[model samples]
Structure formats: C-alpha cells, structure tokens
Target: MSRDERGRGTLEAHRFYIGGAWVDPIGTERVTVRNPADGSVIGTAAMGNAEDADRAVAAARAAFDGWSRTGVEERLALLRRMRAAFDEAAPAIAAHLVREVGLTTMVAEGQSAMCRSHFDGIFDLLPSYPFSASDGGMVELAKEPVGVVVAITSWNAPVSQMLCKAVPAIAAGCTVVVKPSEQAPLCGMLLAQAMDKAGIPPGVFNLLNGRGGDCGRRLAEHPDVDMVSMTGSVPGGGAMAAAAAPTIKRVHQELGGKSANVILPDADMAEAVRKSVFGCMMNAGQTCAAPTRLIVPEDRFQEIAALAVAAAEALVVGPPDAPGVTYGPLSNQAQFDRVNAMLERAIAEGLPLLTGGPGRPEHLSTGFYARPTVFGPVPVESFLAQEEVFGPVLSIQTYTDEEDAIRIANATPFGLAAYVQSADPAAARRVAGRLRAGYVTINFPPWTAAAPFGGYRRSGNGKQYGVWGFEEFLETKAIVRA
Candidate 1:
C-alpha cells in the first residue's frame, strides 16, 4: 500500500491481486488516479491487459472445483474473517472514495459501510436458503455452484458493488474474479488485501485492475468463466452481454436508470420535494437508482419546482473536503464532460430551467464541480426525463392524474427503481404497484439491506442481495433414483 505523502489518504495500488496475492502487472503503462475535487494525481495503478485477465481467470478456473465443493460452514467462516478486515479498513476505504471519486465524506463512509452489510445480509440469508429439496418422489433436486464468476463493477460504488457480487458468489461456492472499474481500482486493491488477510484460499477470490473493454471483456468472454455480473451503464452492459454471448454464460447486470419519484397532490409537497432533490443530488447525482425524474401534479408543478429549487440551494456543492459540502465533483473528467454536455443541450433546447445549468458551481473556479441543477415539468419525451444523466441534475415532469403519473414514471427505457409519495399509505402503495420497476416504495421506507435489488425491462437480468443474489451464482440439478 502506497500513501499520498501529501495526505490525500491511503491507496495506490501498484499491482494486480491474482491467486490471492499481489503480483506485478504485465504492462508498464499506468492509469493515474486523481482527486476529482482539484484534479491532482493521487496515485498510479498499473494498467492491466488481456494477459492479466487470462492469468486471473485461469487461477479462478484452476481452483473452481475445490472451492465450489467447499462446505457452506467453511466458506461462511472465511467470509466472516474477510468482513472483519473490511470493518478495520472502513475509514481508509471512505478516504479513498473521497479522493478517487469525489464522494463527500458522509456518502463515502456510507458506501464503505455498505460493504459490510453485503456480507452480513448474504450471511443472514445463506443459512436458511434452500439448496436442496425432495422432488416429491424417489428423487432430489439441488442447487450447485455455477463455477467461475467474473464481477465487473463501476466506479461510483466500487467496494460495495464488488462484494455485492463476490460475497454471494463465494457463498454459493463459486470462485470469482473481480475486475473493478479502472477509474476506481483502489477499492479492488483494498478488497484483495482483506481477502488475503482473511486467509481465503488462493484463486477463490481474484482482483484484476483494467478498463472494461480490455481485461473486463476478456474475463466476460472467457469460455471458462461460468457467469459475468456487471454494474455499469446500459451501453457497457450491452457490450458485456455481447461479449459473453458466444460463451453462453449467465450475465447478471445492474445497469443504468432514470428512476422516477412520483409525488401525489395530497402529499406533503415541501418534504417530498426536499427528499427528491436530496436523493437526486447525492454523490453529485451519480447514483444509478437516483430519482432524477420527479413526477408531480400539473397544477402543482410551479409550486413544487420552487420547492425543488429551495432544496437544491440548501444542498452545499463545492470542494469535497470542505466542511458541510454535501455535494461534490463528478467522479471523473468523462462524467463531468458528459453531464455538462447534457446540461448544455437541455439549455439550448429552451427547456424551463428552474435552477442550475452548464458549468461548475459559481464558488469553485476549479474542480469538476457542477451546479446543482433542476429542470421543471420537462416533457416526458425529453432526453432530460428519458435518459440517464448520471450527474447531479433533476428533471421534474408534470402529471395529469394517477394514470398519467404512472405512465410518466414508466416512460423511460430503464426501470431500476421508482418512488411514490401520498398522504395515504394505501394510495402510495397502490401507485407503486403499477410502476414497472424492480424496487418501489411508498415514502422512503427504511431500506432492507437483505432485500433483492435488481430491475426489470432494460435494467438488466437477475436479482442481487440476500438469497436472490446467492441463487444467481448457482445452477439447479436433479438427482433421481431408478
């Protein structure tokens, strides 16, 4: 582990973690890790290539049979040890997130803490999970490990996402090779350290640091890998699907979303609007399931737009390290540019911009900081409402009635999540049922960490979290007596 002597915090992954150890990269080229807050080089990670991917995949495949046959109690014991290591490194993980992705301290900490939840949540479900049952005759059926699994995660939530795929796959007795986003590879490095410290058998868990198109695609396409689970953009997911197609491996994707948050006229406008803005603007609006589209009653559009503006104003957007800075810069230059272009096009299209547009927050002359933007009552067909901006931008749309509200909410091609707010719980729940989303809620109910989290429609296939996620890495087998 290399530290930024400048005190930016710990994380400079110099090599790949394969076969349960840190090994030197095959290529000398490196991806420079930067602090998004001010664009300073934090550290350098050795860039990986197809050779690196082959090595990691081979390692996983070599150990697959033994790991796949390991007793459930044995795997759980090791996972608990790995979880303990994660707890000790939570602060450092949060620190790395702040510098690597510009997530504010609070958000970064929350993201880091989520890694533990994934472990415990899956642990809670694994014991009770039905791996085998009688076939109601002289036969039996069982769920067995699916062999090698490759987990490719995005930069936004690296650690949690990695373990979200790895923990469950391991629990299901599947060996895994994780190719985390090259943009935020430190988390992968950190996880590798934790795995090594926990004494996880070599090759049961492997980490390769590289771009999605390079080593990521190699692992996805490798004939030996039994499945590939990716958390990223629709386009990225598409590419992965295409790559894994010929291999005929299972692909579980938790892709992009332009989630809708519908606010019924009878709901508390101020509080609901406040929650919508906060949810949208969190992590500088980089979340996949963020409620970027707010559907409100047409009659209350103006009133709610003003409320949204007030909420955006209350959100502090500036240097991530500054105290009280709830909002920070975009994760990288590419995302910063994409969000700015989207904002510019929306402005040029003459949309009614309620607040914020096109550039850094006025206070910060440098950094990738963007203004907390909110576009009101935008047309449901507009890209602002239909596309995933993946930044701290909210597009509010007007709904004529409950039917129109559900229609507007389901208008997007993506359906990762949806939100509904109403004075009556029954009404909210009723509206939520009509929405075409994997996850729906009336008011922001307390999150169930173990709840299955995957989407319908283009949001990608398979469920994640708890038993649902654990099963994704398993295949059913039926054994019969003659």
Candidate 2:
C-alpha cells in the first residue's frame, strides 16, 4: 500500500467523519475492502449502524441553521477553498480508487478530476443564480435551503457521485451527510480529508461508512434529514423513498439504466460502432448511464456486430497498474459474480456471443475480471437487453426503422440516458428530442459539466449538474407585500 508524506496510508479505514471529527462507529462489525484486480485485502472499514447515522444526521442538523444562513459570497469562498484542497488530494484519491475500486489509473484520475470540476461548475453558477426574484405584482419569490441533506452514493464513480450531491447541497446552503457505498469508501474518506484541510465548519459535512441496510436505512428514515439524494439501483431508491415517506422528505434519485445507442443508417457506421463499443466498455461498463444496448438498422446488424466484436476484443483488461491495460476488474466480488451469472444466463438462452462470454480472459487466471463481451441479435424483451449487467458486456439489437429504434430504446423501464448518431445534426437532434431519457448525446458530443443530468421514469427523478443540480436542494417561498 502507498503511504502519504506523513507515513499514513491513504485509505483511512477505522473512523467515520462526523461533526467535523473522526470518530469510531458504534457497531464493531467491519467490512473488508479487497483489491479487485488481484483479490487481495486492502483494508477493513468500521461498519456504521443506526447510531452512527443518527449522530451524523444530528451533526448536520446542528450545523444547518448557521450554514444555511450564510450569504452567497461566503459559500462561494468555501467552495473555492474546497476546490483547491481537492486538487491537492487528487493524486491520493486516484491511487486509493485504483486500489479500492479496481479502476484503471486513467479512469480513476478522470473521476477524481470530476470532483473538482463539479465544485468549479457550481461556484461559477452561484454568482448569477436567482436566489430571490420579484414578481411584477405584490409578492416576491425566494429560494432557500431544504435543510439537512443525506447523500447516498454508489460504488462506481464514488468521488463524482458524492460531490455531485454534496457540492450542490452545500452550494444551496444546506448541510450534508454523505453515505458512500461500502464497496469503495476510501475515496469518500479522502474527500473528507480534503474538506478537513479546507477548514469547512464542523457538522456541515460528515461521512458514514456501512452497508445500505444499516447506515443507509437509518439516514433515510431519520426525521432530521430533509432530503435524500441517491445514486444506485431502482430497488434501493424505492426503499429509501419508502423510509422517507412518513416524513415526506424530498427524495432525488439517479438510479440504474439500460440506455440505448441508436445509430442511423446514414451515419458513419465504423465510427459510430467504435464509439458505441467504447461507451459500453468504459469503466468496465459499471456506469449507471452506460449505453449498454446498441440499436441498429436490420440490414446493418451483422456489420455493426462485427465491428463491435473487434472493438471489444481489442480492449486490454488486466491489473490497474499493468502496462497497456485499458480497464480493470469489477469493483467487488458481488458485482463480479452478478456479471458472470448474467453472462451464463445469456449463454444458456442460446444468445450468440460475438467475442466473449462466461469466464475471465485467458491471460487472467484469477481476480474479479470478466472478459469484455459483445452479443448480437439480442431481442428487446431479452433479459440481456432489459436488465443492467453492470459489467463489460454489450448487447446489440436490430431496429427496422427510426420509429422501431425509438420503440426499442424506450422499451426498457430505465430512461436515464440515450445516444443518437446521424449524418445530419438536425436529424440527430430530432431523434434525441423523441427519446424518453433525461439526457441524450447526439453524435458523441464532448461531456460538459454544465449540462443537466438525471433520468425519467424508472431510472429515477431529479437532475444533477450545473444550475439544475444546484436548484434541487433549494425550496421556494413566496412573500406577499402588505
């Protein structure tokens, strides 16, 4: 394990950050974090229970009054300091993610950078934000913080997810309690360290590490928490909503998706196919909004399938530190097993595996790695096309026409994101408008942190990113003039 200049390991495993101090969990049970690349134990984190959740929520509630009343300038200053602290800690955060989450160094660094970008984005938008507005008549409209926020983030992209929730909540003048996934809590811990270094006020920000059942449930059920923003499975979000229903707290969820990449016949087939394959294989296909379903024209199915197979086969998967490795293993053993089970089920159903299926790559004898697989002629109703495998697996389905493509794309319960590729920008934009997802990419546009991101339907509700995300934590009020 790599150590910092102070001779301390980057992954601080024993304490949870609450009320601006590192404290022990009430429960003694622990979760062992393993390096997925080689199945080696990295460290053990103290599993928090209901008591821990309560303590964290109490801290946030205590801090909310003062924090929420702070002026916009004050909040912007603190965010600036946070961005600086995050920059200083980026290297350590990247290293820790590589060890604990099994992400390649490149991907890990990008994720770390996104944390700082979110801070920058919010800070830039806060100046011009309309916190208070005047009605032309006898009333004025004002936006206020929604009180203490509970941010429950998933394992994949922990840094980005946590910040996407926490930063915006803080920007909206709300105190936050972050519950990071136990599968990869090290990055969250590192973020806490950055917050500490930035001298953020006590109780304004806290971190709790534990399973979803213990820490997550308690936080969701806690009356002190006014909002629960989460990024995870659909069922997990449902449970959180149910837990918070009695209190009627606001619940914003960015849940699972089986997003589709629709390629028009007029588009450059080779380029579209290559990018689509990369989108599915990126981050080992663990991204919540990954384009896992590739919808193509009936006549072009075989051609696209061949291109996808070649693209998937060319990817180099190995240890995070290995030379030329494009990606790493699944984040944990559970995900590894789940991906394998899905592959086995697809094979059992006689789906033709174009390149990979049912096992680790030949070069890898052990570890939680799965082969980068692509299967073609997948029916829209097939399990492979509907459920999220959350691994490096891609399923290709054919569409008779544009209408059929839209139908197949919207067939799944998920509506997180969609992709459209066409020779004409106007046509792609029109198709993008027709998609049911909350976000759509036309011809692989460069990712902009300023764009609003979220989902529709079963993928979950609420937006996160730039101004839209900032507004999610604010409650509106109207004052009538006498």
Task: Estimate, for each residue in 1-482, the C-alpha lDDT of model 1 and write its tens digit.
Answer: 76543335545688888897789988666777788888888777877898999999999999898988888789889889889888876777677778888988888878866777889886787777788999689889999999999999999989889998999999999999998887787767876876788888999999989888888889889999899999999999999999999989999999999898999989999989998899989889999889899999999877998999999988999877679988889989999999999999999998888889999877888888989999976998888888899998999899888999999999989989999989998899889999999988778777677678889888887988877888899999989988
- Return the lDDT, model 2, position 124: 83
TM-score for all models, in order of appearance: 0.97, 0.97
- Taking the tens digit of each residue's C-alpha lDDT, what string does model 2 give over 14-122? 7888998988889788777778888777677788899989999999999999999999899988888888988887887788788888888889878877887898898
The residue-level lDDT of candidate 1 at 101 comes to 84
CA lDDT, candidate 2, residue 15: 89
lDDT, residue 111, candidate 2 = 89
Worst 10 residues of 2 by lDDT: 1-10
lDDT of 1: 0.87
List candidate 1 stretches off by more than 4 Å: 4-11
